[model samples]
Each structure stands twice: as C-alpha cells, then as structure tokens.
Target: MPGCFINYRTGDGEHVATLIDRELKQRFGSGEVFRASRSIDAGQDYVRALDAAVRRCEVLVAIIGPAWLDSPHRSGGDGRALDDPDDWTRREIATALSLGTPVIPILFDGAARLRPADLPEDMRGLARCQNRRLHHRSAESDLADIIEAVEVAAPRLGDMGEDESSEGDSGQSSGGGVANTMRDVSGGTVAQSREFHGVNGISGRTGDMVFGNSGPVNTGTGPQYNGSTVHNGTGDQIGVQRVHGSRNGGESR
Candidate 1:
C-alpha cells in the first residue's frame, strides 16, 4: 500500500515530483507512493484513482507551486467563481484534511512567497496550515522537512531495518526553523526567461536563447535571445521577445 500521496503540478515541479518519488521509493520500499507519471491502467478514472490513493495513504505530501493557491476550488478574491466544481487540487486537500491525514505542504522554488492577495480564502487557510515560511526553503532544507513531517504523521512509513530510532522521536528533534535560500537580487545570477517556470527556450553558441516566437525577429542572425529585448554592442534593440509587454523592433550589431 502507498504510504504517502505526493501532489504537485506537472508543468513546473515535475522534476521535483519525480525526485521525491524516487527518494520515497528508496526510503520506503517500492510502491509506497503513487505518482501520476506511473500510469497503471489505461482509460482509468484518474481523479477517482488519485482520490482513492490519497484515502489509502497516511500522509499527503503537497508539493506546492504558485499555481496551487489560485486553484479553481477556492474562491478567488471578492467571492469570484472558480472555473471548475471538482478541482483536483482542492479535492485532494479536502480529502487529506477530512481523513485527518497530515498534509505536509512542500514548497517548490519558493512559490509560497509569490502568493497574491487575489487568492481565495479557503486556499489561504491551506496556506496558513503549512506555511512556506515555516517549511518553504531550498530542496535540501525541504528534504529535512519532509523527513520530519513524515516522522511526525506516519512514524512507521520508511524502513527501520538498520535504523532503530523511531520516527516520532526523530521528527521532533529537527527544529522548526526556516532557512533562507533566495537568490541575492544584488549579486545573484538572474535566471534566464527560458529557464523560468513558465518559459521554455533553447540556447545558441553565443549564449543567446530563442523560444516560442515564430516571427522574423526570431529568425534573425547574430546572437538570438529569448528575453524581452535583445541588446547589441551599442546597447540598441536588435530583436524583441515580448513575453507580456510592448516590443521594439530595431537592428544593432
């Protein structure tokens, strides 16, 4: 039986989810966790299947991103309607809470801090239950949190073969401290647009990147970039990649 149900968005945190699944499998034997990527039956009721999996699990590990807060199940700001009646994320959270399952909220890429005021009230409650600030740190820090949360909620989860210490004893040992892993705005490396959660692109030999745009600008020679604007030697616009704003088409060498 699966001991933990890991919830996550397939778009941004897929890699993280896979990593967690791998770790869980290593820590606990195989088939201890259910991940969507491992499709069991063809044409199965995926939502129902996932819900059932959650029901059987002792822990619901919510691998959250910014998208989780704005889910359709929760009311948007000012009682705005959600787009769906049975949002998977909302149902997953509700099921976990209803079943008294420990919903350990895991922050992916510091998404908890990015929550907007427009988020729904119920979603806010979920956020309050397991704050990113309390546990939202780097992947390494989160691993420690995961170990702690599971130990607290499901003491018999992983193998205690060589390790005689009980999870309950070890879980409470780790301090409830939050670690700061945010990149330095002043000196840290800026993640390229293509490398962001929402954007995708390919890099060229000159370190320029190109993405979704099929316009002539993307076809231009010299270094091609996927940012908002490309700069030449004189700091003039050579091409524009408007992700969410105006574009200026100019040529510079």
Candidate 2:
C-alpha cells in the first residue's frame, strides 16, 4: 500500500506532483508513494487502481494549481473539469474526502486558498482544511515542511524516510554522524567537518585525511594542497587546489 496518495490534474499541477513523487520516493524508498502516472501499471484497470491506492494511503496530497478549478473538462467542450463527477481529479479527491482520509492541500503557482462555496458539496470540506503552498523560489523549504507533515500523519513513512537518510551515515562513533557518501559539491571550502560521511576513499595521495574520523587542514605558507576531495560523481577526476594571497584556481598537482 502507498503511504501517500498524490492527486493532481493532468494539466494543472502534474509537474509538481511528479517532483513531489520523485522526492518522496528518494527519501522514503520505492513503492511507498503512489502517483497515478508512475504507479499505475499498463493493462490494469486504473479506476480500481485509483480506488485501492486511495483506500490504502495514509494521506492524500491534493496538488492544486491556479487552473485546477477552472480547467476545461477532458471529455468535451469548455465545461469545468471539477464540475464533472467522473473527472479523475474530482473522483480521487471526492473519494478521499468522503472516506475521511487525511488530505493535504498543496497549492502552487499562486493558487488561491480553496473556497467551500466554489467546491462541489461533497468536497467542500477540503476548503476548510488548512493548506500549504509551494513556490519555485521556496520549493526546497516548502517540500521539507510537507515531508515533515506527511511523516507525522504516517509513521511508517517516517521510518522509511529516516532509514534512507541514514543509509551511509558517516562521522565518529561518538558525536554528530556523517554519511558514507556525500553528494556532489559544486564549489566551496570545507574545513574540519566533524560528522560527514565519506565514500569511495580519496583517489589520489590523501594527506591528513580520515574516512570516518576528524582530520587536519593544510596550514602551510604560500600555496598548499589541502587535499580537499571534490567528488563530482563523473568518471573524470577534478582536483581542488588552494593558493594563498592569490586568486583561487588550479587543482593540486
């Protein structure tokens, strides 16, 4: 069963839905999140699939964009999609609302807060529920809040997410922990990090470096090779060199 069910209209907020799905899956692991586009298998009855997912999910995330309520119906002319009971988005949300499932409204693209007066009678409750917003400028922080909220609603997701985060935890046996492998670092100076998981080992000659323990930094005169490893994840190796009293350039030779 999916821990979270993502309900989104195809044209309105599907992109954000996909982004949320990817992030949740990355943090929680596979099969824990249900997004119709990615979770529904070919040759399966999508209606039943949707019903089952909604029923099993701990919470339903409704992605509401600006066009959500006014989007044209899929079947024919210019009728509003939300006005149609058979609409996929409408059906999914209505079912979740009727079933008393936890529904989280995530409005993006400057969407206005839902108005109960504008909603279908059965789904009017959705308007009264507190909502969250997602903006491109603050997507990262917004998603963090969203994940935290979902984790609260579904304890199973919390376990899955934490396990994934601590997969390669690094650092000393005591104190803050590190990861086994760090994500690619673009550009910056890192000195004396206490709890950073190091993976793959330093390719070149490593000076004053410890994989899991704290190490020293280069405090030499003129220019010194601090031996700070930059893992870009590409096959090619890029060296980082520190030159004192001059412009910062060139990797250590």
Q: Residue pairs in steric clash, candidate 1? A: none
lDDT measured at residue 246 in model 2 versus the true structure, 0 to 100: 24
Runs with alpha carbons beyond 4 Å of true place in candidate 1: 71-83, 113-125, 131-138, 158-253
In terms of lDDT, the poorest run of 10 residues in model 2 is 244-253
**lDDT against the true structure, each candidate:** 0.54, 0.72
Top TM-score model: 2
**Residue-wise lDDT of candidate 1 within 175-195, one digit each (tens)?**
222122222224323222112
Candidate 1, residue 235: the lDDT equals 72
Residue-wise lDDT of candidate 2 within 1-253, one digit each (tens)? 9889999998888899999898888667668899998999999998899999998788899999999988987877667888887888888888888888889999999999999989988789899777888999999999998888788777888876666555435332222343222233224443333222333432332222223223322322233333555445687665765322321121222
**How much does candidate 2 score in TM-score?**
0.67
- Each candidate structure's TM-score, on Cα atoms with residue i matched to residue i, is 0.51, 0.67
Task: Report the poorest 10 consecutive residues by lDDT, candidate 1.
Answer: 244-253
